[model samples]
Target: MALYDVLLALDPSPVVALNRAAAVAMRDGPEAGLALLEELAGARRLRDYHPYLLARADLLHRLGRLPEAAEAYRAALAAAGSEPERTHLRRRLAALAEAGHEV
Candidate 1:
């Protein structure tokens, strides 16, 4: 995490920021991470990045924001680079459906 802070200070790269957001989510909570992601909403590099979308979806899901999570999962699914990633996202969407939110 310290390394991330240093790297971000030096580079301010969107990918590194996203990674730091994930780490913050792990150490703090979904809301904190979601806040960081919100700060990066305008980052062009993350617009179609599946991993960024995945992190946001996971955090929203953890926070019980099912509809938002489903939307993010849909976006992630669309951006996914592999069949396995698509399958995983599909399962997450199915779970949201089971929870009464359609993706």
Candidate 2:
């Protein structure tokens, strides 16, 4: 944890932040991860990063923030260039919608 903190403070890269956020989520809870992702989203640094949005959306979905999750998934899909990634996002979106989510 201390190592992650040092790295985050020294580098502050989105990838580092994301890893730190994942660590926090595992150590703390989904809320912690969501908070970190929200901060990153506000910074607009991971707008074009598919994994970032997918992580945010997954966290939101798990937290029952379906509408926001759907939006995040859509954003991820829009930015996704690979067929596999787009298929995955579409599948998730479809699953959410099928589960009565407002996608």
Candidate 3:
């Protein structure tokens, strides 16, 4: 988190911001990380980035926001750059669907 903060001060790149948000989510809570992701969602550079959607999906999943997480996972799958990533996101989405509202 400290490294990401320093790098963010110097660069504020979308990728760095994404990592920082993940770290914050890990240390603080999923809501904190989701807030940062929300802030970055408007950035043109990350509008279609798979990582951003994936991160949001992960946080939502942790928070037990199943429907939102499932949607975000689908979006991440659509934006995924690699077949493996898409497959992983698909599995997550499928699991959520199988769980239904119980998740």
Write model 1 residue lDDT over 1-103, tens digit each, in one string: 8988999999889999999999999999999999999999999999999999999999999998888999999999999999999999999999888877877
Give the per-residue lDDT digits (tens) of candidate 2, residues 11-89.
9898889888878887888899989877887556777888887888888888888999999899889989899999999
Top candidate by TM-score: 1
Distance from true location, Cα of 66 in model 1, Å: 0.4
Error of 3 at 59 (Å): 0.4
lDDT of 3: 0.89
* Model 1 / residue 35 / CA error / Å: 0.2
RMSD of candidate 1 to the truth, in angstroms, is 0.8
Query: Largest lDDT belongs to which candidate?
Result: 1
Candidate 1 is scored at a TM of 0.96
